[model samples]
Target: MKIVDVICTPGLTGFYFDDQRAIKKGAGHDGFTYTGDTVTEGFTQVRQKGESISVMFILEDGQVSHGDCAAVQYSGAGGRDPLFLAQDFIPVIEKEIAPKLIGREITSFKAMAEEFDKMTVNGNRLHTAIRYGISQAILDAVAKTQKLTMAEVIRNEYNPGAELLPVAVFAQSGDDRYDNVDKMIIKEADVLPHALINHVEDKLGAKGEKLLEYVKWLRDRIIKLRVREDYAPIFHIDVYGTIGAAFDVNIKAMADYIQTLAEAANPFHLRIEGPMDVEDRQKQMEAMRDLRAELDGRGLSVELVADEWCNTVQDVKFFTDNKAGHMVQIKTPDLGGVNNIADAIMYCKANGMGAYCGGTCNETNRSAEVTTNIGIACGAKQVLAKPGMGVDEGMMIVKNEMNRVLALAGRRK
Candidate 1:
């Protein structure tokens, strides 16, 4: 199929973007908005509405294959691309990108995705959001051209020997961690409650007592509310490095505290992500490696997940090769092209590192659906329910997409 035309539309994401730097610096929450000066650049407030651009490609057969260009919730922090605003980038796509995409042949997804993913304007590569969305459209176009599901295209091109199956779905509970846990339990999410424990003093507590209490409560609640006695969901919490702040980045202390959490979780598995953020990639990797070693040496079964500094496919390999964490969250938007997501997940599985196909709540339904296909195609350990922190909507989108892909692929056999 050949690209006949290109279209771009400005849109809203499912959630708002928060300045992570400002939030960490003690920005108080007022209702859903933050009450403080914005720390990161390209922000009118500490929190603002998220924006997206839908890139649609018109093929010769008149099929419209589209993808949503969206950024992470904590944009511009942790070595990511600067803030993505539709007003600023829509024109860039029309002027710089649309021309190149107009006459391209939809021959190979991997070849075309990598070409545009590395394309640059004004001496810098295109923003990750743009590359992410454009690559999705490319994949969809190729799938439509080949009369196959997106998952099938990825499997055929990337991992022909892989089986198309459903991946475990991990859901996030934004600030409504308490009520949302009920929703997650009711739905029986495979990975329950990514309790957003960003603040040390409030969420994690000055000495980590608050999070411990929360984990205990979570364990009890799951046991009480589950419909089946055997329904055991993994407890995966993202602390955003609050544990490190509370314990002064002491590896021994952090490991000890995690042991307490694991005990609190009792029969359930526990995976803690971003336990400490040293703010530099090298330092962050070393901390993760040391912490993982400490946990293993003590025979602790708790799993450590690498986030923050582990943003790209290269970062995933770096952390995986060093055994920095048991699992690495392949944050979809940060990796630019969807091709990298496929490669990262395969690499992690090959290296015996858990690959969590995760993306931001600050995304669109299209992006979530696309990533779900990629996760299933690559055989990732877990796929995140995304586009919103509210458990139900995100779960429905991800879970339904997985089922639909699996059903369609099954028919082919």
Candidate 2:
């Protein structure tokens, strides 16, 4: 099929873009918004509504294939691309990208996605958000031409031998950490309560006491409320580097504290993400490696996950090569094209590292569904239920999409 036309439309994401730097610097919360000056560049406020652009390709047969271009919530931080305002990028798509896409043959998704993903303007590559969305459209277009689901297309091109199965779902509890746990428990999320523990003094406590208490509470709550004893979910919390700050970045101290958390979680497995962000990619990897070694030396079963500074396929391999963390979060949007997400997941799995197909809550439903399909195709360890902080909506979107794809693939088989 050939692309007959291209269209772009500005839209709002399910969640807001939060300035992670500003929040870490003690920007107090004020009724769903922050109360401080913005620290991150391109952020007019400490918090702002997230933006996305829907890129639609008109196939020759009158079928429309589309994807949403969106960025992470913590844009312009951790060496990522600048803020993605729809107004600034829509024209770039209409003028620069549209012409190139129009009249192109939709033959191979891998070839077309790589060509545009690496294409540059003004001596720099296109924004990750743009590459992300355009790649989704390309995959959708190819799938339409082949009369196959997106998941089938990926599996055929990337991992023909891989099984089409439902990846485990991980749910996040943005700020509503307490109430959201209840929702996650009811839904039986495989990974429960990505408690957004970002602050040092307030969330993690000066000596890491607050987080300890929360972990104990989370364990008890699960044991008390779960209908079945077998409904045990992994406790995966994103501390956003607060644990390192609390323990002065000492590997031994961090390891000791992590052990305490694992004990608090009891029978449930514990995975701490972004334990420490040393602010440099190399330093972050080294710190994670040392910490993982420390935990292993002490016979601790807690897992460490790398998030910050591990933004690209190269970064994923770099971290996996060094054993930086037991798992690497393949942040979908940060990897630019959806093709890279598949590459990252396959690399991690091949290297004996857990691949968590994770993305920001500040994304559109289309982006979440697309990444979920890719995650299943690549056999990621866990797929994040995302696009919002609220548990129910994100869970519904991710879970339903996985079921539909799996059902279709099963019927075909």
Candidate 3:
């Protein structure tokens, strides 16, 4: 197959205004979106309000032409300006990079991938994003062209995908464990009168201390589970890393806390999600090393998964070089593109570390599906469920796709 054309689809960016009222009013439902007044009915209620850019990959072989597509929905975070992405990132794929791919023999994806990197020089502003879109489209093209299942192509190219069972550890800040009572109520009950009451109030309310209490309640509940339970199996915990106690829990305290939780709950592993402030690559590695040393000293045997620091490939290499982390959490959009992500994963696996592709709260299902496919294709050990388990509808989409992929791999058998 040869590249015939590449197109960009433009639209407004979307903002997600969740029904805080519903969440405040109702109890949680299957860890997905809660049902109640304030919350939107489902995922579609999550809307795009501003402009967005979508790129389509058009390919031709002999007489046939078909399109493969990728889209980037931009939004700002942490009070920062809208991350000036898309346009800055897309051209790297549609212009500078796509032309080189046009007449090349399409048999070797690895070779094509190498060429794409060399041609772009890896320092382009949109290198990661563009490569991601381009790589995703190309992978689809290659799979379609060869008539091979995506899983088949991936397995042939790299290691087999791991059986992924992701667990959720709600991000909370503080001492009170039961902070989000509405969500708790929704999760545990089928119907709630309180949801109606809160929904009427019209403000999505979350008391910081109360939220902490809710998280503590959740943590304590999980801590109550045995290593091998008939019901709640030992799984993983994702700490958005805010403990009501302190953000910087000393190494000993942090180690002690992890060991306590690991012993009590016997989780498969613990992933500390972030907002850690590491000024440069060296400091980042030091933080990882420090955490690793503490874990080793405690003899906890829990793996430290890196998210905040492993934002780029140089960061990944730094982590690998300094013996920092046991695993890496890769956010596809954060990294920019599929090829760059592939390089990161390959770097991890080839150097004897594991990779888990992370998901976001804001991703649409279409994007979620593509990430899952890429997670397997790129050899990530596990993939996080998106839209979170709190949004029942979105969770269902993620769970269904994840289950389908797992079933294809005969994980249940």
Candidate 4:
């Protein structure tokens, strides 16, 4: 079969899943507020609009599939300008990528992926979001074409018997209100096991002792989860730069906190992520090294995933060279393109480092699925998105595909 046609579905929306409900100074009490206002003297507010984008693919054999391509709310090239990215890319899919594939073979996923990559490159400036759209639409189309589930494809290609356990992530909202340190810990601890136990008490309040109790309670909850689940589902922490620990001075405290988390975590498995205010590459690596050393001394394993600190290839190298961190938390756009993100993952893998695909709060369904494809191609072990992972339509597409693949292999069993 040859390529046939690509069409973009109209409608795009923005949604904010900020854990913090209070306005925050984006930087150093910067006084940025999201009062649902258009303009605030020193605050950056979100209009909280409902915008969405979807696309349709018509294959050569008269087959068709529809899916979302919006990356997290403000994703892709011009993030804050989703309307523009959608305006520009939707046309490309309709006029360029779709038309070329109208008569092409759809038997090979790799071939289809390559075709899109080539098309993207030829366009001079390729946006991963565009390629993401093609990859996702085709995956849906191919799954339909072959009548094979997405999990089946993954199992056949990668981890055949691997089950996709529930992934728990600490959700972050732009506002800081939801970040009441103790409440955040308790809520996350309750995520996987609210039925059995509610970590927070009826008259519970926040204080130093209460905070310590909350941490210890979180630890117990983590350990209990490990004991109950056959496979230890991974837990992700989104610091969101809320940790007031200064890199140079508070490295010990950071390490201590991690150690407490690791010990309380019965299965002894935990991964922590942050966009800490380390300021620069050298400082970031140093902080990681110190934290890693502290964790090692306590026989606790930690995968220090870098978020904001890793903006480019050079940044990745610094972390790898110094063994500052064991995992590279890649934000899709920061790697420039999907292929570039793939290269970074490959590099990390070759060096025996783990890589995770992460996203910000403002992601749409279209973009999430695209990021899912990117994660698969880049060899990511897992992904970190909102806890209500598949709420977005874009994410739902990938989630459906993964479920299909897993179901086909009986992994869900």
Local accuracy of candidate 4 as per-residue lDDT tens digits, 1-413: 55467667656443532212222323123333244432322113343333334767776677677655444433322222233245556677666666677666777555565566556446464455565455666666766777665424433444334444432322332222223323334333312211111112211121113323444555555545443444343444545333423222376666665565556554535666652446666787887767666667777765666654676666776687777766777665444334445556667767877766665444555455555554554456665443222223323444554444345445425
Model 3 deviation from native, Cα RMSD in Å: 9.4
TM-score of 1: 0.97
Give the residue spans of candidate 3 off by over 4 A. 11-52, 61-105, 121-127, 160-216, 219-249, 260-270, 350-352, 377-379, 387-390, 403-413
Task: Indicate the worst ten consecutive residues by lDDT in candidate 2.
Answer: 23-32
The C-alpha RMSD of each candidate to the native structure, in angstroms, is: 1.2, 1.3, 9.4, 7.3
Tens-place lDDT digits, model 1, residues 1-413: 79999999999999998898998798997988999898999988899999999999999999999999999998998778999999999999999999999988899889999999999999999999999999999999999999999999999988897889889999999889999999999999999799999889889999899999999999999999999999999999999999999999999999999999999899899999999999899999999999999999988769999997899999999999999999999999999999999999999999999999999999999999999999999999999998888899999999999999999999987
For candidate 2, the lDDT comes to 0.94
| Cα shift from native, residue 111, model 1 (Å) | 0.4
lDDT on C-alpha atoms for all candidate structures: 0.94, 0.94, 0.48, 0.50
Better of 1 and 4 by lDDT: 1
**What lDDT, from 0 to 1, does candidate 1 have?**
0.94
TM-score against native, each model: 0.97, 0.97, 0.64, 0.65
- As a whole number from 0 to 100, the lDDT of residue 291 in candidate 4 is 69
**Candidate 4: stretches off by over 4 Å:** 12-14, 17-33, 36-45, 73-85, 105-108, 111-124, 141-147, 150-213, 220-235, 244-250, 260-268, 311-322, 332-350, 364-380, 385-403, 410-413
* Residue 38, model 2: Cα distance from true site in angstroms: 3.3
**Residue 355's lDDT in candidate 4:** 69
